[model samples]
Target: MSDSTTSIKTFRYRLYPTRAQEAAMFETLRLTRTLYNAGLEQRREAYRKHGKTLSAYDQQKELTALKEACLEFSGVYSHVLQDVFDRLDKAYKAFFSRVKKGAKRAGFPRFKPATRWDSFKFKQCWNNAKNDWTACGKPVDDGRRISIPKIGNVKIKLHRPLEGKPKSLQIVLDVDQWYAVYTCEVPVQPLPTTGSSVGIDLGTTWFAVTSDGEFIENPRHLGRSLGKLRVQQRTVSRRKKGGNRRKKAVKQVAKTYRKVRRQRLDFQHKTARRLIHEHDLIAHENLQVGNMAQSNLARSILDAGWAGFLFQLAAKAESAGRRVIAVDPRYTSQRCHACGHTGKENRVNQASFRCVQCGHTANADHNAAKNILDRGTSTERGEPLGRAVPSGENGSGVSHAVA
Candidate 1:
């Protein structure tokens, strides 16, 4: 596909809506939830009785009938419900295809209501005229806005100028906060190619160590906020269940956790952007983040967000037209980067490493980073390398190092 046709990027903007707008959003969410659950029920019953799965086209056909049956509810075609049906049909089709290919576990789908639907709203398309977006349901004239269909004018933070044609827009709610996500079709502008390369080693103790001898210290956001979180948890635990005070306390705790997540994501995006911009070729170990999350140090491991970091890095590198290479991570830390000798005794402590054969000394993570860079460079040049061999000590498993 041409770059112009294939390139797309999503931008998220926070939303602040009036009380009336909030109510409308809640109604939209409620209708969508009902439609989704009903569709899910249809799929489940079909499988239970006839052992048949619905294809995307088939689900769409069924949904058309369902909508026709609900024509009396004028708002059923208000664009929001239509989008919900479209999404539900697409989801079932994808899920069944996965099951057929053994990519997912075989199971019937289930249905759930939208008790919390009042928390959000959505519309598929909208138009903008004179900085105001108009759609079917209601006309919004907020100066801070994005245009969408059927949903009319919606408010947005407008933090940055939009760069491309808006292809899709979604309004989402998290806790009591609202946000807008816009998927835009952007023209590809690949960065000028260069021969620069770098290797990275990710750790739980430190966020990341570069082959160039730079370390990104772990912020440990969760660890830092643990005391405050514990106090909130204690207060909630002491409240009577189902009481208004208990619910309020629960929301406060959830909001705190969400804040930590948001901060971590922001940090990852910045770090990934910096790395992709600095190097033409990047190399790092391909880590199994899921496996790491199950380890004894899972809390710290999750906090470092190795998987999220790699995901962001890879995505940004792709957009920038940079090469990201994953090489075997086995023995990268234990092996001597200078002498090509591998031994367990090389990593003498949490922060230090001393090669037994070459007697080269460096920080453990730094040494690992160098090895990762070497492996990536070799792989890019078509050199053969052995699979990662697990160190067996410190429960570290060797896997593909992703750049």
Candidate 2:
């Protein structure tokens, strides 16, 4: 495959560091976080006192002197420390970009608390040579362990075989457990064409309904784990703050939530993979889920995770050489697919749909899926995207030409 590798994927592996190794990693974390906070304060102070913003490069150039002064900084790898400044630089740049766009929440970069800053990255892991990792970071001892600069070889559980060339490594802390996340570049392996297309209607009650009459069920991952979460939360409340017992209780609560998140993520990945494998062209509504969640049904809408599913579907489709099209969602639910009759009366209820003019009845989600398919096909035929044509006795609908 001469095509340039465009797909950048991430892989996570559970790490089992010895107590001493873990302590060293924690030291690295503390040093990097302190550096980040100090850099932020410098920028703010410079701007407030001199009306001049301190750029990342300006602070990065001062690293050598800071390391010489602070003996502890010399203990950590230089590249790892440098990454901290680079990350803060990105945060500041993003904040400014958002403010320029008049975003609602142009949040300034704030100092990260100990609990919030759970990860540290090494800027250079694998050298430019393919499959060759730098001495600072590499999978050694047959992938069972990884070498980190400050911390010695940490035992790792390589659950899945690593693919692609590793570019960087991130050490992450989830509650009390440690993980190594690898960023890699892999060439795409296109799947065989399926020669089929389908439109999907996503809902809270049901995960998805396809124009082909397949109904996908929603697992309600968070809803199912609510009981355990409630119990852990209650335990956390019973313990006094700052106590080791309370911290443990908090971790318990976080563990349950983590499991729920993983479950939801796994479900989305599998569903997206299946859709990509089955359909050459998959169509769905271009839903503004963020805006949709601003109402009373926010909990259900968020829990359904329609946005996550669509994102996964699109990404998988791209890698598989399939097409994913998003159609306008305006009247898909209310309009009658059978007669192209646009009216709210067509929606008998959430699950039922009936066209008054054509006397056509079907499941609401199924009808919407059909309408999405029609819209998507028209778009592929060079029709205006997101345009809904009204059709009735006046025959005001999109016309087709025979080949």
lDDT of each: 0.71, 0.84
- Which residue ranges in model 2 land beyond 4 Å of their true spot? 1-5, 46-55, 93-103, 129-131, 380-382, 389-403
What's the lDDT for residue 374 in model 1? 85
Query: What TM-score, over all chains together, does every model reach?
Result: 0.80, 0.87
Model 2, span 125-144: residue lDDT tens? 77775647797558789888
Compute the lDDT of residue 216 as modeled in candidate 1. 88
Encode model 1's per-residue lDDT on 112-163: one tens digit a residue: 5543443223443335454433343222454366544434466767787665
lDDT of 1: 0.71
